[model samples]
Target chain A: MNLKFKHKEVRVFAPASVANVSCGFDVMGFAMGTPGDEIVVRRSDKNTVTIKSITGDEGVLPHDARKNTASVAVQKFLEHVGFESGVEIEVHKQMPLGSGLGSSAASSAGAVLAINRLLGEPFSRKELLPFAAEGERVACGTAHYDNVGPSLLGGFVFIRSTEPLDIFGLPFPESLHGVVVHPHIEIKTEDTRKILRNDIQLGQAVKQWGNVGGLVAGLINKDIDLISRSMEDVVIEPIRSVLIPGYDSVKESALAEGAIGAGIAGSGPSIFALTPGEESARRVCRAMKSRLDDIGLPSDEYISQINTKGAQVIDVKD
Target chain B: MNLKFKHKEVRVFAPASVANVSCGFDVMGFAMGTPGDEIVVRRSDKNTVTIKSITGDEGVLPHDARKNTASVAVQKFLEHVGFESGVEIEVHKQMPLGSGLGSSAASSAGAVLAINRLLGEPFSRKELLPFAAEGERVACGTAHYDNVGPSLLGGFVFIRSTEPLDIFGLPFPESLHGVVVHPHIEIKTEDTRKILRNDIQLGQAVKQWGNVGGLVAGLINKDIDLISRSMEDVVIEPIRSVLIPGYDSVKESALAEGAIGAGIAGSGPSIFALTPGEESARRVCRAMKSRLDDIGLPSDEYISQINTKGAQVIDVKD
Candidate 1:
């Protein structure tokens, strides 16, 4: 019997998400556009997986399907739900690596979402979250859902739990607009985690929790003033801000330009300003660019609204 | 100078409040009725500070003006606003001391509120919060606003900051019902604070903030089910519950009997149950009492609603 060669391919794009959102620390995240990655997967009748090619990585990313985030996620998905076949994965990385803008998560989320559709959509969107998070663990050493949850599910998300025993996803209000800026630099997530203190003063802990609560309420109620007031960090941001250039000036300038608030995005190199409208977001972008110029650093800005649509199959070809 | 009392003496009773409200830990609180202290202050030109009597204390309380909560609160109020004349303060200690019902805060809040009225209401209600907190420090060794904020201002309160700069007095929904039970034993607030770990895990911290945010929403929306579900703890209650007799049993029984949620009140010795209606509150009281009985402990239960009217001038007798 001769094996028939038929090619069925699908490609999906997942947007970059700004995790932490300043005071939210771990619970809140928002999706962004313009800077995202495209993942393409082709189904084959072989029991083995292969990485056909990779672009825009500049020789840094692995070509092995099992090693790359996009591949690892597909592998995990196939293993969990019992897949009798394998596929070839290709990643077209548009977002910068280690930019703190969910670059790796975009690929992973895109891959899982695209491949799941090719597999006839066996699982729900939430069921794909842990798999994509597992992909993030390949690069960051720990599975942090802050980035993956938003990238996979889209819009603003509150991760109630991640311990495998019990996980909760709360509703995020629709009125929030996330303004993200990616400074052309790299700050690894590991370094960001290392900068944080193992122990904090009791007084600082109370303030941290207070801001977290305030930020959550601000998001839920869509209160711009409360969100601005709540976008403060007395713990991690204070410590992590030292690594990023023009951190204080950019954030202050953004706020002065009518942006509700701005803070170090994720672990650094990327900064996000939250504003109420496109006009304020544009002013915030100009202010941010000026601050970066003053500090001898340049940045790319995106005045994008919060992306409510997370991951989906953009195209399928037979 | 001849001492003459021109104005009528007013006695105000403010109910105790449960601070930390499970997962809130220090940011959220709500007022409760029954088993609360009463403060009576008289306008006098004698400039005399006095504590008339003390009761419901098992030798744990002092009757001296300097040591009593009511006297200390009135004295602090006078010094803060620079009252030209002093006032006489009397305490009717109806609530049990060291029962975690915020007994100290009730006396302090009631005294400050009554004295403020006696002085022609010179300062606003919010201005009396710090003065009352000072009195609580005299009894608890540390100045905490959780109990004092709610007791003085009433309803649900979120203590955003606690220092020379404090933020509180947010609007709370009027639909909350707070059911409490005080077992006839003593659990010192100082001991409770001492037993808590100074540092908490980051995972637990996230959950704590999520619940706190949920609680604020619960209060704002007047959603009883949300309030009940948000009543959870990852830091304080687990450690404190072991000290209270039948704490787990009572909590389980209360929830089993239609109560939304139950947890250690303030710092234990008193446990509170939150329910939607009078019927559920009564059921919770019975459940809590039966748990106390099973554990061979004598308990006093109070089925009460959230006290929207905090500390007020009940009567003015010349």
Candidate 2:
């Protein structure tokens, strides 16, 4: 491939994401502003991808380029663009792993985005979703986009289908704030997924889809009340919440602190609440954290508006 | 309670509705423009409700005020307002019964709307949904608002819940046209519902809600391609289509005729297709009817844009 390199090295930051978003399990998600993964990509003389270093994950993440999410995503991008030269990837994990805040997705998104910048931007950010999702497939068994979609593209993303790759960016209230509290506990996505029932009642499914419709409509119309009312999970949360300690109390505290709605973030060990403004988001975060404190569980809390600019190039070296 | 009547009599027309709308089973529906039911209501000195007459039903409809959907809705509305004087209702069923075109919902919506007009409009159109839904409960043994919601409010409606009565008006493309073809057959709602499996696979539910979110976003953004792509029913249609003869062929014909999407209207012997404009709608209507015609099955077809004005007073007498 005759692709010219725009930069010798590039750095990118991909935001963390809250997937499922209560009623919209496996379909809807939004990017957060902080606690995201960073990827550093450098043009290499070798013809193969390699992961040079990792940080913030306590040496838990894989270093092999083929096995690691970041390198896998970079490798996939290079293959797609038919780049003869390879790239070296460095992953800086700024968030908790297995916390349900889309850790793997962030790494993948950051890697691809960073490399895309280095390669003179062969594809738009939207076009890079599949490569990021491929990394998700390596990390988890399924190549779901609910995480990578929002992480890469920013804002609220509604993934219609993964096979045909039908994804949509939904409009949300400008004042909308999200409070995410990740308790210092590990709950693997694969494990939480295993605990879910294979079959759910038709009535429950009906209620779920109704809320899904309501949530989408609420987000589009920026109806906070409607969004609050629709942010309920009758199917997955009921089963998954059991895995998180003090989940019920933490969620109640968020709501009591004037949050519009609260639910298990991704596969749990983290609880997220959405409020109308930053003040309410802060209040919700404090309340949720206090509940965890009372239960003697340490946690990390984040407050963010919707990250409208998803993965971006932070710095580049020629 | 004393209430001055603005009119001695009032007549209302409530349009028929298509419920489910593919991926949004039991939660979404839209109002049609024609082939609706007409309700004439007259104030009476008697303290009890009465069904004065019924037409176009071939005597299949009930005359008993307590049993009939129209009278039952009127009775509920009267009791709510503490009205001592009763009202006599006359139902003119312009649409076919047992055809999955929201037959009972139209009668109920028209009755409540007509009576409310005669009583000086005590309830706003939005406030009259429960009364119409009560009539639905009496008719179907369950108070589902998907049909009555659109039939009463007009436009596309996303029903979040029937219990707390959370219904939101959704914005849709004005150029959108619907083609409904009612195959002259009876498939009872109760019977078709019985055939549905109580439990659905979790994966299927995920895909269904994904599409639900997609459809709502599509409607809000007025993206025709997204709307068409999202109009899929993975759970309900596969089971219900068995009862409708030549359902596959009919749907294929509609799609081949340039319909954006097509699905069983409500519980179905009626199938509805949505097209981008009047031209494609007419083509789809002919195509669907031809499929039914090929099987020697007689059908009635109606082409309509969305009925933005749902139930409205057509006439008044002092």
Candidate 3:
């Protein structure tokens, strides 16, 4: 509660997220362990915010505080909470851009969580979700919490809405492991957005909604077989899969190798498959990576369990 | 159940049903307490099916066994189980036609259940769902189980689909009461179907699906407050409300009278509100009836609890 003797420099890390999650486009996402972003928030004498540096962005990232997601989140938080001390932020993008792995969400979520911790934890984590979602808006032209919510809150997060920001920490099977494959191609979120149809058929919508209900019920009941069956989304996957390289092949390979379900993560170039345990995760990862390589889109695979603790304090310096 | 010593005459009563339940269109429904249909199944010496008499339909109902829902359902049941010998069916319609209160579903459900009882209970109640649904298809041109599922299985029935008949008997608060108001008018389901849009916008679909998931979760958790909030059906109610007389005024009055939520029951011409107990049910019924009266549409009100027992034998003679 006291901030006078707080650490001068604090760094926090937020995990990469897989959004859409098949049946729930823009409404559901889950956190992965390995690929993540870190943000460093340092105290200064001046009563203003600044972005000192951004690494791993290849010089394309902005320096201004208002324009960038991490700094904008910091700016928004400071302005709302009336924390007037100067804060300098350094964004370290460990995740790849345009990988559909929620890279932008990680940076913004890490920044706000770190800055909040450094400034004595003035706001609750739930209160800070909107700022992270707002940061995602700057990167993707939409304020969606599917990625940012899970990245910040950890585990599997279901975002019912962004307005007033309703989020639920869904109960997923503890043994669930995610096999994620990120290919070396850059498919902009905007370009992926262009592929999706503006309007959906009624039959498809009903079928998809039924699957959504079944999926939630599956998670709540801890029925892995039900989860695998309910994850068969009829609406978005049929259309959006065309944009991803070796999409069908990857899904087929993953399922054949004991993965419960596989689909395009977020907007795609990246793909993810959910398996029951670590063994299936490894098998699915290998299968998916092989499919991508056979299709001339050699990719990197990461075997991860669901990140239960989202963003956490990595280091603090005096 | 032994068929050789079958009952000479049997009469079965099936409770009326409320389909859709706002958020889940064509996928969910529940049975109400009163104003249900009665069907008489009699064993005859002749080797042909016949409809002896029809009541309460004012001769609008077909006399041919093949054309009627009750006889069609009976025929389907007999054909599936290879039951021989002649059977006579007498139709009785307790509820008004096109009341948006599952009148057709009640007829089919009552018929199948009664015949199943007469033939010695060869099929379980779950297996009888398809025959009832098939009978519903003859009545409404769609084999949806929203009405028939609840009318046969009772309680809060959710039909994920009718193909393999994926149904969940959702655990709802036992004290929940339904207040129904049916105006002296008829809106054909076919006519109501013409008013609905064929395609839905992506944003609306996501919000609707999220609410559906929330609804299932709320029912599972027995969180009444959450159910009340999650029952908002933005996708269906907006488009279908136009078919009902004084729809907005009636819904406004119901919610104003402390009803948790109110919407068009299945299609139009009838409105129902869910309340916590009998007292609130009475209050909501009065509020909704007054609204219909103010709009010059005198309506009848029914305050009933959930019909946990779907269809039952009123009288059976050996």
Maximum-lDDT candidate: 2
Docking quality class, candidate 1 = acceptable
Provide the overall lDDT of each model, using Cα atoms, as 2-decimal numbers. 0.78, 0.91, 0.84
TM-score of each: 0.87, 0.99, 0.94
lDDT score of residue A170 within candidate 1 = 42
lDDT of 1 at A83: 76
TM-score, cand. 1 vs. native: 0.87
- Taking the tens digit of each residue's C-alpha lDDT, what string does model 3 give over A1-318? 234427799999899999988898888899998789889999988888899889989887889887899888888877777677888989988888888889889998998898888877877888889888788788888878988888899998877666656688788899999888998987788877787788998778888777777777778778887688778778778877787778898899999999988888988889899999999899889888988889788787788999998888899987
Chain B TM-scores, listed for every candidate in order, come to 0.93, 0.98, 0.97
Candidate 1 per-residue lDDT, tens place, B75-170, comes to 887776666576777678777777777889999999988877766677787888888888988898877888888888887777776754445555
Give the C-alpha miss distance for residue B236 in model 3, angstroms: 2.6
Docking class for model 3 is: medium
Give the better candidate number (1 or 2) by lDDT. 2
The residue-by-residue lDDT of candidate 3 on B1-318, one tens digit each, is 225426788898988889878788777788998889999999988866788899999889888988888888888888877777879999898887888889889989999888887877888888998898788888899888888888888888876655555776777788889888999987889988887889989878888888777777777777787678767788889988887879999999999999878888999679999898999999889989988888899887788998888888898988
The candidate, 1 or 2, that scores higher on DockQ is: 2
Local error of candidate 2 at B32, Å?
A: 0.9
The 10 consecutive residues of candidate 1 chain B with the worst lDDT sum are B1-10
Residues A275-298 of candidate 2 have per-residue lDDT tens digits of 999999988899999999999999
